[model samples]
Target: MRHFSSSATRTSRHRVIGALTAALLCAAGATVPAAAHSPATPAPPAGAPAGSGLALTPPMGFNNWNSTHCRAEFNESMVKGIADIFVEKGLKEAGYEYVNLDDCWAKTQRNADGKLEADPVRFPNGIKAVADYVHSKGLKLGIYTSAGTRTCDSVGIPGALGHEFSDAQQFADWGVDYLKYDNCNNLGVDAKERYTTMRDALAATGRPIVYSICEWGENKPWEWAAELGNLWRTTGDINDSWNSMLSIMKQNLPLAAAAGPGHWNDPDMLEVGNGGMTDTEYRTHFSMWSVMAAPLLIGADLRKATPETFDILSNHEVIAVDQDPLGKQGTVLSSDGGRWVVAKEMQDGSRAVALFNETGSAQRISTTATEAGLPEATAYSVRDLWTHTTTNTAGGLSATVPAHGTVLLRVAADKHWAAYPPAVELALDGSALVEAGRTAKLTTRVTDLGRTPATKVSAALTGPAGWQVRADSATTAAALATGRTLATRWQVTAPAGTATGTYDLTLTTRYRAPSGKQVRSSVPFQAHVVVAPPAGGGYLSDLPRLSASNGYGPVEKDTSNGESAAGDGKPLTIGGQVFTKGLGAHASSSVEYYAGGACSTVTASVGVDDETGAKGSVAFEIWSDGTKAASTGVLTNDMAAQSVSADVSGAQVVRLVVTDGGDGVDYDHADWGDLRITC
Candidate 1:
């Protein structure tokens, strides 16, 4: 629920180089320089209050900002109906307790006595009445206001800046359980002082109200807000898009040590059911947020929510990780290219491992129990939190994750290997690329990692419909000993006229556990069908990209960088020059095109787009195959467009990359003006 205009005054601040830049640069074989500021975990401020004993775990609830905003639908009836749905839909039982009201719930002005008043038309029965109703249902109520003189809404309702004590007293009397104090129109007051004033006011009322500091991390709230609020906003607002969520996750992932049992780092609210992203992406968002120990505030309208939304929100196993008693936030174990491995230590001696794929294509991401910080054991129980399935692993934990998807696993040391299926790791051993209608030799390797030997171990590879798969040799094994692998090669043929794209091939293995129970496990492999592009020369924008990912929003085609929505960009402009064609991308973006080893050169005039004026800086790199073919060291909006020409001859893939220029991604709108590839 953050609102800030482009012209709004804010103290100059820069974000620490987050995981996105570091990981992507590392993957590109670039040395990452040290950040200007220390990346150390910030210690809690001295004498930090222990909080109100509320929200010991990150709060789970619903906020109307993302779904309803300040619309008329967000009235008293809507509020009460949400509370009812929370009970009827089993959300309340699933540990979602708070029914929060966001901005515009109050009148434009304060009452005669300088006390804030709810809008009569919106909350006809008053906030206390709604609070009573929520409490009757065994849930708590939260209300919103800004720490400045006005709220975030355009009309600007009365804020709690100078009226903290009176407002806190009123909230206490009204049984408000949570206070989402925002930052807006602060008149340039010190952030710590403004937030700490409300903390003191809330405490003075002797009411257990959870304080959420919504300063948008402009003041490095994680460094000092721990003592002032239960949770602090770590980034700006989150729109319902893959880039937005992923960017925010990168921003929050580095501050793990600042979070604890009583204090949390809030990356805004959940956008799971908001409809902009696919279910796969939503699951990644939820899983990543849970692993980060962020608050699980449902930001979708529950009344109209689909079953899929509820399913993603009600995943109890993932929720348990968010609500773990130890309250430790997860940190990135490794991130390369678009694959990330994050692990969180649980209170029950388990480790929650999230294998996240942020690319546009499916990828095989792997990690080990030891890498996840699990103590050595004969076997480890790996439970898929999303699929609700438990399997044992000797040490390897891996999965082929779909694009923008996450596989959440809970790994724990287990001695009861006899009761569970033997851990069999399935992997593909050769190149996954095959020309359409051609046969590819796919090798399936299954390794037995359990303590006991497995009998009747068999494997089969199955592709999409109309595709044929035949084992090159015996696919069945009579017996497999511990730590032994059974490898089989299969001739997989794609049907003629098959589309050129990535397709899933399943590798299923059947074996008998020590208990003689037939156990089946299947792992997915991505088969890339490469079709040579027609010989041609054209603007890169007009060519179909193999894959594209932007750091801020979708990559713009022949337009200036715009907001999160696609097709919202303006004319492609760099400095004072406007072009009719090119790609407008944010920093930390990549667009891969199928060159088919035919394109001889890629040329572009690149610089920070004029859309961001003189505020942005970025570097443009053209990668042919896996090697850097051309690069512009760094270009700012004030600089003239720099011409780049990359020799991409014999390169199958040409990737256009924009980096944040080692400062930060803020305002890094890069333009590739008149970009063209010649064949």
Candidate 2:
């Protein structure tokens, strides 16, 4: 993060800085050679005389890594060739800067003086000359480095860990404008410390270098990455394919609130210039990232530019949203798997919303209404950022977005969004599950998505199976939709004696709409109340949950499809018959299987009372959809659990059923969460 005055000597220096130590160093005088650290050479402040247009804004330029990096016997001429054209055709004027050399650009190590130098094989004229050329064109220069012992390219060299500040000085000496700090073999307490270390190192360089920390959010560094560097990687590297881009974007949007002007969520560089995806998908990629406020680090060869690529990158309206002086990141307001609605507040108090569909199949996303906590009704002149046209619609809100695409509009509260008030307000990350004999309570408020506040509205709560209702929200005609959303809550208190199980609570929004239809919107409320297993509970209480950290293998075929009571329960009723015929896709048997017996096979607790019944053992069964298995085994006090591996593959034709393994009131609640199959 170091920089030298134009009149200073050029000497590359590298050194190791201690972890977490803040280093303070800046270039002499007011000419801050580097500005906003735009992944390129950090641009000096906007009007620092060393910056070009949009310098205060994040740079929109292309790199070589995503698509083609140093291929085809290319060298400095290849990189400089692109910059020359960028300047010649006024691409810089169009707001694209920082022709960067991502990887394979640096040497194994610095010279005897501890200077970090570029590989002579690639940039023969040196990074300084390239920086000068880039500067001549009114653009900025950028370089890359590794945070681990090596880079993604796997070169055997020391990383910035023990040598952060020193490397910062070296970059400044080389006239480096931007430093792309990568994480290859990095190991630390977590992502925060690693990023924090480099951030301080760059600062120590005394040069205004943008520290772009690439850790891929292994430990959620975005939570506080901004404090350490200008940008931090939020996900793994993205490819030029639609699926890859979509996956990366999916996880980034939720963390949008973490980004701002100086610090951004880096999506491991842009794949816009990459040829793997179609032009349409590329545009969608750009649109999604811009809306989410992710760093627009172009990852394609800028030298061989495409018209379509230029169009996607140069959309003024989209770019406006990305570079909005407000510097706010867009976040998901509502989301389903197929479609999602996201919003970002703009400087003019206007809110931009994008309804995006990410499915291969056609999907429809509708924005019913919303509220932004405004006092009075406001009108908005809704304009589509993609089509660049005004949408003529009645009422002050909502839109239906297309499939595999998005509908981004500047929702002017006073214009179109004015008439709406926020109605449905959802709180907590999700529903709270009360264990059996426990209580569940959560609080949330709703406001108007429009200018008019939701004054008085009613809410109703309903549930399935056993639900103890506490209050009828509708009795108060309580505030229905705030900001157009209904302020409502559903709380169910299951006394210690309540049955142990998961119950679904349905929340229905009832409100007197401006249209006077008394709209009722239903949202599913889920609650899991697992009765504390009456003291010493759970068959395998110490077993790990099947999660990313603890993956479980699939079921192996070693048990029997027999007719005996080895299952310990009466003959399992199959297809309404006592005989185990027509069970599963098999010709016979819902019979008991064994694995954990003697050394039981997958054993379970059938909670049934073995105290009074002769037919009290739970049996295993399965129903499959192609290959997805829905295996069910009984849980009872009598026959705790029995495993039967009846080959449930293509399990669609099978139905896992549990029955008659308990005496009346035998506490036969079949409780199972970690139903893992070990291969």
Best by lDDT: 1
Q: Against the true structure, what is each candidate's TM-score?
A: 0.87, 0.55
Task: Give lDDT tens digits, candidate 1, residues 1-679.
Answer: 2211112222111111112110001111112111111112232333445244556788899999988878899999988899999999878877888899999899998878998888999998899999999989888899998888887676768889899999999998998888999877676778899888888888777667788998888878899988778999998878788877887898899999999877899999999888999999999999999999999999998889999999999877788788887889999999876789999998778899999998776666888999999878777777788877666667888777777889988888866545667677777873366667788787778888666777899998888888888999878998888778899988988888888777888889999887788888887767777666556788989877677888777898999667666787888887789899999898779888877678899999899877775587789999997689999898887898999999999897788998888876788888999999998
lDDT of 2 by residue, 74-161 (tens): 4678778778877776556555676777777777876898766777888788888888887777776778877766555545555666
Q: Candidate 2, 245: how far from true, in Å?
A: 1.2
Alpha-carbon deviation at 173 in model 1, angstroms: 0.7
Q: What is the lDDT of residue 110 in candidate 1?
A: 88
Say what the RMSD of model 2 is.
18.6
- In model 2, the worst 10-residue window by lDDT is 547-556
- Model 1 pairs whose backbones collide: none
Model 2, backbone clash pairs (residues 3+ apart or across chains), number: 95
Off by over 4 Å in 2: 1-59, 70-74, 88-90, 187-194, 368-379, 396-400, 414-679
Superposing every Cα of model 1 onto the true structure, what RMSD results?
A: 7.9
